[model samples]
Target: MQRTFKSKIGILTHILLLITIILLFYSMWIKSIVFLVIMLIINVLFVPSFIHTEYIFNNNMLYIKSGYLPVIKIKLDTISEIISHPKKNSLFTTNPTKRYALSSDQIILYCKDNRRIAISPYDKEGFIRETIKCNPDIKISE
Candidate 1:
Protein backbone atom coordinates (compact mmCIF):
# COMPACT_ATOMS: atom_id res chain seq x y z
CA MET A 1 0.00 0.00 0.00
CA GLN A 2 1.14 3.51 -0.79
CA ARG A 3 0.61 5.86 2.11
CA THR A 4 0.75 9.66 1.86
CA PHE A 5 0.89 12.28 4.56
CA LYS A 6 0.41 16.02 4.25
CA SER A 7 1.00 18.71 6.82
CA LYS A 8 -2.04 20.94 7.20
CA ILE A 9 -1.90 24.68 7.50
CA GLY A 10 -3.18 25.88 10.85
CA ILE A 11 -6.20 28.17 11.12
CA LEU A 12 -4.51 30.45 13.63
CA THR A 13 -1.53 30.93 11.41
CA HIS A 14 -3.73 31.95 8.51
CA ILE A 15 -5.68 34.32 10.71
CA LEU A 16 -2.48 35.95 11.89
CA LEU A 17 -1.23 36.27 8.36
CA LEU A 18 -4.50 37.84 7.27
CA ILE A 19 -4.35 40.34 10.11
CA THR A 20 -0.86 41.30 9.22
CA ILE A 21 -1.80 41.76 5.64
CA ILE A 22 -4.71 43.99 6.59
CA LEU A 23 -2.57 46.05 8.93
CA LEU A 24 0.05 46.44 6.28
CA PHE A 25 -2.50 47.54 3.74
CA TYR A 26 -4.02 50.06 6.12
CA SER A 27 -0.62 51.57 6.89
CA MET A 28 -0.20 52.50 3.21
CA TRP A 29 3.27 51.01 3.27
CA ILE A 30 4.55 49.89 -0.13
CA LYS A 31 7.21 47.66 1.38
CA SER A 32 4.66 45.91 3.57
CA ILE A 33 2.39 45.29 0.59
CA VAL A 34 5.33 43.95 -1.39
CA PHE A 35 6.32 41.64 1.42
CA LEU A 36 2.78 40.42 1.98
CA VAL A 37 2.30 39.81 -1.73
CA ILE A 38 5.52 37.90 -1.89
CA MET A 39 4.48 35.76 1.06
CA LEU A 40 1.11 35.07 -0.51
CA ILE A 41 2.78 34.01 -3.73
CA ILE A 42 5.17 31.76 -1.88
CA ASN A 43 2.35 30.13 0.05
CA VAL A 44 0.37 29.49 -3.09
CA LEU A 45 3.36 28.14 -4.99
CA PHE A 46 4.59 25.90 -2.22
CA VAL A 47 1.59 23.64 -1.83
CA PRO A 48 2.96 20.95 -4.11
CA SER A 49 6.25 21.15 -2.29
CA PHE A 50 4.62 19.80 0.87
CA ILE A 51 1.41 18.12 -0.27
CA HIS A 52 2.14 14.42 -0.54
CA THR A 53 4.96 12.79 1.40
CA GLU A 54 5.32 9.11 0.62
CA TYR A 55 6.33 6.07 2.66
CA ILE A 56 6.62 2.70 1.00
CA PHE A 57 7.36 -0.54 2.77
CA ASN A 58 8.34 -3.67 0.88
CA ASN A 59 10.68 -6.61 1.26
CA ASN A 60 11.69 -5.69 4.79
CA MET A 61 12.69 -2.19 3.81
CA LEU A 62 10.96 1.13 4.33
CA TYR A 63 11.32 3.85 1.71
CA ILE A 64 10.68 7.39 2.83
CA LYS A 65 10.58 10.42 0.56
CA SER A 66 9.80 14.06 1.19
CA GLY A 67 8.79 16.66 -1.36
CA TYR A 68 10.61 19.86 -2.34
CA LEU A 69 14.10 21.15 -3.16
CA PRO A 70 16.33 18.37 -1.94
CA VAL A 71 14.50 15.02 -2.07
CA ILE A 72 15.63 12.52 0.54
CA LYS A 73 15.39 8.75 0.72
CA ILE A 74 16.23 6.54 3.70
CA LYS A 75 16.29 2.78 3.95
CA LEU A 76 14.85 0.82 6.86
CA ASP A 77 18.18 -0.90 7.59
CA THR A 78 19.62 2.47 8.53
CA ILE A 79 16.97 3.04 11.17
CA SER A 80 18.10 1.84 14.56
CA GLU A 81 14.99 2.55 16.55
CA ILE A 82 11.60 4.24 16.25
CA ILE A 83 10.05 5.91 19.25
CA SER A 84 6.75 7.70 19.94
CA HIS A 85 6.32 9.89 22.95
CA PRO A 86 4.99 13.22 24.15
CA LYS A 87 7.27 16.20 23.73
CA LYS A 88 8.45 18.19 26.69
CA ASN A 89 6.70 21.52 27.29
CA SER A 90 10.01 23.39 27.35
CA LEU A 91 11.05 21.91 24.04
CA PHE A 92 7.76 22.84 22.42
CA THR A 93 7.98 26.40 23.72
CA THR A 94 11.50 26.83 22.40
CA ASN A 95 10.80 25.64 18.87
CA PRO A 96 9.43 27.90 16.17
CA THR A 97 5.66 27.73 15.84
CA LYS A 98 4.42 25.75 12.86
CA ARG A 99 1.48 26.42 10.53
CA TYR A 100 -0.18 23.12 11.35
CA ALA A 101 -2.03 21.81 14.36
CA LEU A 102 0.32 20.98 17.22
CA SER A 103 1.02 17.31 17.70
CA SER A 104 1.13 15.69 21.10
CA ASP A 105 2.95 12.56 20.03
CA GLN A 106 6.40 12.98 18.57
CA ILE A 107 8.06 10.36 16.41
CA ILE A 108 11.79 10.00 16.75
CA LEU A 109 13.86 7.94 14.37
CA TYR A 110 17.28 7.00 15.66
CA CYS A 111 19.43 5.85 12.81
CA LYS A 112 22.15 3.26 13.01
CA ASP A 113 24.59 5.82 11.63
CA ASN A 114 23.90 8.18 14.51
CA ARG A 115 21.38 10.39 12.82
CA ARG A 116 18.02 11.40 14.23
CA ILE A 117 14.88 12.55 12.44
CA ALA A 118 12.09 13.95 14.58
CA ILE A 119 8.54 14.25 13.30
CA SER A 120 5.29 15.14 15.00
CA PRO A 121 2.64 13.44 12.94
CA TYR A 122 -0.90 14.82 13.07
CA ASP A 123 -2.41 11.35 13.38
CA LYS A 124 -0.28 9.89 16.11
CA GLU A 125 -2.05 6.57 16.52
CA GLY A 126 -2.23 5.90 12.79
CA PHE A 127 1.40 6.80 12.34
CA ILE A 128 2.42 4.48 15.14
CA ARG A 129 0.32 1.64 13.79
CA GLU A 130 1.71 1.99 10.28
CA THR A 131 5.26 2.32 11.51
CA ILE A 132 4.98 -0.70 13.78
CA LYS A 133 3.58 -2.70 10.91
CA CYS A 134 6.69 -1.92 8.92
CA ASN A 135 9.04 -2.77 11.77
CA PRO A 136 7.40 -4.74 14.53
CA ASP A 137 10.43 -4.39 16.78
CA ILE A 138 9.94 -0.64 17.09
CA LYS A 139 9.25 0.50 20.64
CA ILE A 140 6.40 2.93 21.17
CA SER A 141 5.77 4.85 24.37
CA GLU A 142 2.83 7.05 25.32
Candidate 2:
Protein backbone atom coordinates (compact mmCIF):
# COMPACT_ATOMS: atom_id res chain seq x y z
CA MET A 1 0.00 0.00 0.00
CA GLN A 2 1.25 3.42 -0.90
CA ARG A 3 0.13 6.48 1.06
CA THR A 4 1.13 9.84 -0.37
CA PHE A 5 1.38 12.88 1.92
CA LYS A 6 1.51 16.46 0.63
CA SER A 7 3.47 19.34 2.18
CA LYS A 8 2.23 22.91 2.35
CA ILE A 9 4.93 25.38 1.46
CA GLY A 10 5.84 27.50 4.49
CA ILE A 11 5.47 31.26 4.69
CA LEU A 12 9.12 31.97 3.96
CA THR A 13 9.10 29.82 0.89
CA HIS A 14 5.87 31.40 -0.29
CA ILE A 15 7.38 34.84 0.13
CA LEU A 16 10.50 33.87 -1.79
CA LEU A 17 8.42 32.43 -4.62
CA LEU A 18 6.33 35.59 -4.79
CA ILE A 19 9.44 37.75 -4.89
CA THR A 20 11.08 35.59 -7.53
CA ILE A 21 8.01 35.79 -9.76
CA ILE A 22 7.76 39.53 -9.32
CA LEU A 23 11.40 39.97 -10.25
CA LEU A 24 11.08 37.55 -13.14
CA PHE A 25 8.37 39.72 -14.74
CA TYR A 26 10.13 42.93 -13.78
CA SER A 27 13.33 41.71 -15.43
CA MET A 28 11.38 41.06 -18.62
CA TRP A 29 9.89 44.55 -18.58
CA ILE A 30 13.31 46.19 -17.99
CA LYS A 31 14.97 43.86 -20.55
CA SER A 32 17.82 43.19 -18.10
CA ILE A 33 19.57 40.08 -19.42
CA VAL A 34 21.63 39.45 -16.26
CA PHE A 35 18.71 39.90 -13.89
CA LEU A 36 16.49 37.73 -16.04
CA VAL A 37 19.03 34.91 -16.02
CA ILE A 38 19.36 35.00 -12.23
CA MET A 39 15.61 35.12 -11.71
CA LEU A 40 15.16 32.19 -14.06
CA ILE A 41 17.63 30.13 -12.05
CA ILE A 42 15.90 30.96 -8.80
CA ASN A 43 12.51 30.16 -10.28
CA VAL A 44 13.73 26.86 -11.65
CA LEU A 45 15.49 25.78 -8.47
CA PHE A 46 13.02 26.86 -5.80
CA VAL A 47 9.69 27.06 -7.56
CA PRO A 48 9.31 23.47 -8.76
CA SER A 49 10.71 22.15 -5.46
CA PHE A 50 8.61 24.04 -2.90
CA ILE A 51 5.52 23.92 -5.07
CA HIS A 52 5.53 20.16 -5.29
CA THR A 53 6.66 18.10 -2.27
CA GLU A 54 5.21 14.66 -1.87
CA TYR A 55 6.08 12.15 0.83
CA ILE A 56 5.38 8.62 -0.24
CA PHE A 57 5.05 5.79 2.25
CA ASN A 58 5.35 2.54 0.41
CA ASN A 59 5.25 -0.70 2.34
CA ASN A 60 8.14 -0.55 4.85
CA MET A 61 9.94 2.30 3.14
CA LEU A 62 9.28 6.01 3.38
CA TYR A 63 10.33 8.20 0.47
CA ILE A 64 10.78 11.97 0.77
CA LYS A 65 10.63 13.33 -2.74
CA SER A 66 10.49 16.87 -4.06
CA GLY A 67 9.76 17.45 -7.72
CA TYR A 68 12.26 15.26 -9.60
CA LEU A 69 14.73 14.34 -6.85
CA PRO A 70 14.39 12.02 -3.90
CA VAL A 71 15.31 13.84 -0.71
CA ILE A 72 15.36 11.14 2.00
CA LYS A 73 14.40 7.52 2.16
CA ILE A 74 13.95 5.62 5.43
CA LYS A 75 12.86 2.16 6.33
CA LEU A 76 9.83 2.20 8.55
CA ASP A 77 11.31 -0.52 10.74
CA THR A 78 14.32 1.68 11.53
CA ILE A 79 12.20 4.37 13.11
CA SER A 80 12.85 4.19 16.83
CA GLU A 81 10.74 7.09 17.99
CA ILE A 82 8.44 9.66 16.42
CA ILE A 83 7.76 13.09 17.87
CA SER A 84 4.68 14.96 16.72
CA HIS A 85 5.94 18.33 17.89
CA PRO A 86 9.50 19.08 18.97
CA LYS A 87 10.98 22.23 20.47
CA LYS A 88 12.21 24.76 17.91
CA ASN A 89 15.95 24.55 17.08
CA SER A 90 16.07 21.56 19.43
CA LEU A 91 15.39 19.27 16.45
CA PHE A 92 18.31 18.16 14.27
CA THR A 93 20.53 20.26 16.56
CA THR A 94 24.08 19.04 15.97
CA ASN A 95 22.53 16.13 14.12
CA PRO A 96 23.81 15.29 10.65
CA THR A 97 20.36 15.76 9.11
CA LYS A 98 19.16 18.98 7.49
CA ARG A 99 16.20 21.28 8.14
CA TYR A 100 13.25 19.61 6.44
CA ALA A 101 10.61 22.17 7.28
CA LEU A 102 9.96 25.73 8.41
CA SER A 103 7.97 27.07 11.40
CA SER A 104 5.25 24.49 11.46
CA ASP A 105 4.08 21.61 13.61
CA GLN A 106 6.59 19.16 12.20
CA ILE A 107 6.81 15.49 12.88
CA ILE A 108 10.28 14.47 14.02
CA LEU A 109 11.56 11.02 13.17
CA TYR A 110 14.26 9.51 15.39
CA CYS A 111 15.93 6.60 13.71
CA LYS A 112 17.81 3.73 15.30
CA ASP A 113 21.05 5.16 13.98
CA ASN A 114 20.77 8.14 16.37
CA ARG A 115 19.71 10.53 13.62
CA ARG A 116 16.61 12.68 13.57
CA ILE A 117 14.69 14.13 10.57
CA ALA A 118 11.95 16.72 10.64
CA ILE A 119 8.99 16.80 8.26
CA SER A 120 5.73 18.70 7.95
CA PRO A 121 2.77 17.07 6.25
CA TYR A 122 -0.63 18.57 5.63
CA ASP A 123 -2.35 15.72 7.44
CA LYS A 124 -0.14 15.22 10.43
CA GLU A 125 -2.35 12.83 12.32
CA GLY A 126 -3.15 10.77 9.29
CA PHE A 127 0.48 10.55 8.35
CA ILE A 128 1.42 9.40 11.84
CA ARG A 129 -1.40 6.90 11.93
CA GLU A 130 -0.46 5.45 8.53
CA THR A 131 3.18 5.21 9.56
CA ILE A 132 2.26 3.43 12.77
CA LYS A 133 0.02 1.07 10.84
CA CYS A 134 2.86 0.18 8.52
CA ASN A 135 5.22 -0.51 11.41
CA PRO A 136 3.55 -1.52 14.60
CA ASP A 137 6.86 -1.65 16.49
CA ILE A 138 7.56 2.01 15.90
CA LYS A 139 7.00 4.12 19.04
CA ILE A 140 5.42 7.57 18.98
CA SER A 141 6.38 10.37 21.34
CA GLU A 142 3.96 13.06 22.40
Candidate 2 lDDT (Cα, 0 to 1): 0.80
Q: Tens digit of lDDT per residue, candidate 1, span 5-25?
A: 443334654565567556556
Stretches of candidate 1 off by over 4 Å are 8-67, 89-105
State the displacement of the C-alpha of residue 38, model 2, in Å, after optimal TM-score superposition.
Answer: 0.9
lDDT tens readout by residue for model 2, 96-119:
344455336678888999878777
* Span of 10 residues, lowest total lDDT, candidate 2: 94-103
Residue 112, model 1: lDDT of 76
Give each model a TM-score.
0.56, 0.87
Candidate 1: C-alpha lDDT:
0.53
Model 2, residue pairs in steric clash:
none
lDDT against the true structure, each candidate: 0.53, 0.80
Which sections of candidate 2 miss by over 4 Å?
Answer: 91-97
- Report model 1's TM-score to 2 decimal places: 0.56
**10 residues in a row with least lDDT, candidate 1:** 94-103
